[model samples]
Target: MSNPTVTAAQANKTPVLVAICLAAIILPLSFVSGSIATPVISRELGGSAQALSWITNAFMLSFGCFLMAAGALADEIGRKKVFIIGVSLFALFSGLIGFSSSLIWIDLMRAAQGVAAAAALAGGSASLAQEFEGRAQMRAFSMLGTSFGVGLAFGPFLAGLLIAHFGWRAVFLSSMVIALLSLSVAVTRLNESKNPNAAGIDWPGTVLFTAMLALLTWGLMEIPSKGTTSVEVLGLLGATVVLLILFVAVERKVRHPMLDLSLFRYARFIGVQALPLSTAFAFVVLLVLLPMQFIGITGMNEEQAGLMMMALSLPMLIIPMFAALLTHWISAGLVCTLGLVISAIGLGWLSQAIASQDMFAALAPMALIGIGIGLPWGLMDGLSISVVPKERAGMATGIFSTTRVAGEGIALAIVGAMLAGFVGQGIQQLSLAKDSHTASLAVQRLATGDLHQALLELPSTNALQLTAIYASAFQHLLLWLAAITLISAAIVFAALCLKTVPTEVSETLCEPDQ
Candidate 1:
């Protein structure tokens, strides 16, 4: 078999590079479709707040769990072959989601879609890195970053429009179109990157890793709904810990580990991983909390809030190209770290915003946050793969992709818990302040449904008191977000400040088989 080669004159492979970027773009874009549909689905299915979040978590848990295995498979099989299979499954299941009438069906479909997405995403990034070296990789990566930002940015607005005009079902319908286009381009232009001589798949490592991630993600998702003491959540967490420990032991013994734990030996590799994980943690929290705050506290409709929040997405498109250019002259670590700090500032600013604050004022902070997303989104993988041998690109990309999804899942659970706690404390304070007769009624209204309805029924005599309490509660929640964002910023700084050397070399440093 002859290898497909690029010549000096036939070097116009921008289409292939764009297609690779598009493949990555499609994975996250489809993820947003379900994420933004949660609130709308809740209305349709009489779903609980807990259920709204599970829709996102269900997808993330599956995607994160199987990512490492997907990467390993890409190396064992072939990148192009795995890419096509993943996208076909993704598109098929994504369309089925639109027709789902019940919550259980939707959750099941979402999980399957996640499994398929992990394959496409893992292979897509590895193929891109393998196909384009040095300057070309940088440019293609920068574009990919912009697309990543764009997909997330567009998701809310798309969902909002579909919900307002056609209903939530339209969100899934749109995914079918995007998935088809992505699948078509991938099938036509993408080439394989597998080495036939690479060792067979690490079946033991794959099973253990998937189990560890799934259990942990499930535990995290359950925490806000079941409370920290719930027997089920505790048992899941315990099992996850045990499985994770077992996974580490197994990986050490496997000849060709799915994750290649040895990559941590390189400081650059560690930094690259941290850049995305921390940024994703902070970023996803902002994505989830802001719309909730705007809708719940500010009396804005979902569409209005989603559109206004597009500020976060706009910067994602602009900043990554600059990051690519910066890497041409400066350390990639420094560039990524700077992006994280800027994003932290944005999240801090967001946490400080008051209810009904002007959109422009909020956008000021969001601009910095968008830039932060751009930096890491644009450069982290390029930097990480640059340091590793070509053969290990699939595994490296998989690990990074897994971490990214896991970080988002963890943020969702933790932040959801924080928000519920804040609201619960406020309810307690509100109830305690009322007369004994009114206390029961107040608690009932708050618990029944429709927080606004509960607020409206408060006697005029107690109106001011209840309003003050709600205001205090909202402020406390914002403060908590600010603190978390600041902590994430600190971590990004610490990771980026470490020394690292960058090179445009081939499959040499940190070989996969080592």
Candidate 2:
């Protein structure tokens, strides 16, 4: 017969679990809808390429920058209180985004939405950790992962349908309804939880960390336009390094540190942390790039492109349900390592298929990528929090979420820079080969993703050559991405294979503070 204590504990956990899962679903829905609507928004507002990029980057940057501080605040004050505020702000800003007539206003609104998301994510994850333990905790986190996967899987398709029927404004406006639903559930169900003994917020450390990330991201985004060595880029890069050093120094000395450096001593924690960064650099970045390719290269309409993306998103929804079962049979570390390896192979396959430029040939590889990503997507959140004491759940969730979003943001900047550089070089080379100024201008237009304009301007002879050049440049970019992904897989494998017993690792992670 079940113990009364254990039974009562689980009964109490049920509502909290539901509330966190609902909150988890909201942020990804917001992000993916914005991604799907980017092209339409850009055209309608007559925004520049940089402005278009900012629409997405602004959200990611603010979300990542504030996560640690939000996490610390949740621990210091109360998770439920912070979460309610976050949901309300997310709903408000999301509605404001839909009404904006200018790209600048939209970007500002997106950044504010991201800040709200940070608070909700950190607080919700912490609340889950506080309410569950051991196998129950694993199941709870897996459910949260499944909810996130569901959001990603349906976000684009839903956004497409909304945009098709009601226009791009519908995409942002739709989030308001979701936010209100989540907010109501949270208020009714979630128990207030916090670390009562946790000290005051470390404002200095927070400022330094935020400044470092902002500078690093700005420098990366400027690389394509200003060149790596330009004064603006170099100054930002140098300042980022200095701020990082200062942030580390402050965290080390603070009584209530924002990030606990001691957590890095556990090899298991290190391995789990790498999961987000590597996966985001490879999988999340591809999700963004592939949709653009579908529209620009394959001549697919928005709805068709969103449908094709299902080849990548559907498996994410289905496979996360199996995470707990898989963990029972295999170590979480081994599972994550295998996932990374599979993702690398899938990326290589995708590179080849993209070079072929046959839409049908790409679908199978897209499914492979989906399976690869899905394998570890569910396990990562569980592993990240499980390795730490319950009291520090907010900190663990913050680091995990920060790395996840920051990795995606950084990868996007790097990939954008690389694509622009490759296309520019390809255009210059083709111009010299053809010896026609008109052909050069046409290729330049293609490089900027104005494929229709480029085709209109190109002479028949130059059109074929320019298309070939563009394809070659794209193939080269994908190959580089694949190589980076494989290297990340190797690193994950090595980290997880360290010599340590499972019990010893657990003790190291969960030992009480000195």
lDDT of 2 by residue, 19-138 (tens): 778778878877777777877786688665667777778888889988888888888789888888888899899899988899999989998998999998878877877778888987
How well is each residue in 201-250 modelled by candidate 1, as lDDT tens digits?
Answer: 78888788777777777776665446678899999999988998988999
Whole-model lDDT values for every prediction: 0.67, 0.76
For every candidate structure, what is the RMSD over all alpha carbons to the true structure, in angstroms?
Answer: 5.4, 4.1
TM-score, one value per model: 0.84, 0.90
TM for candidate 1 is 0.84
Q: Which residue window of length 10 is worst by lDDT in model 2?
A: 505-514
Clashing residue pairs, backbone N/CA/C < 3 A, model 2: none
Candidate with top TM-score is 2
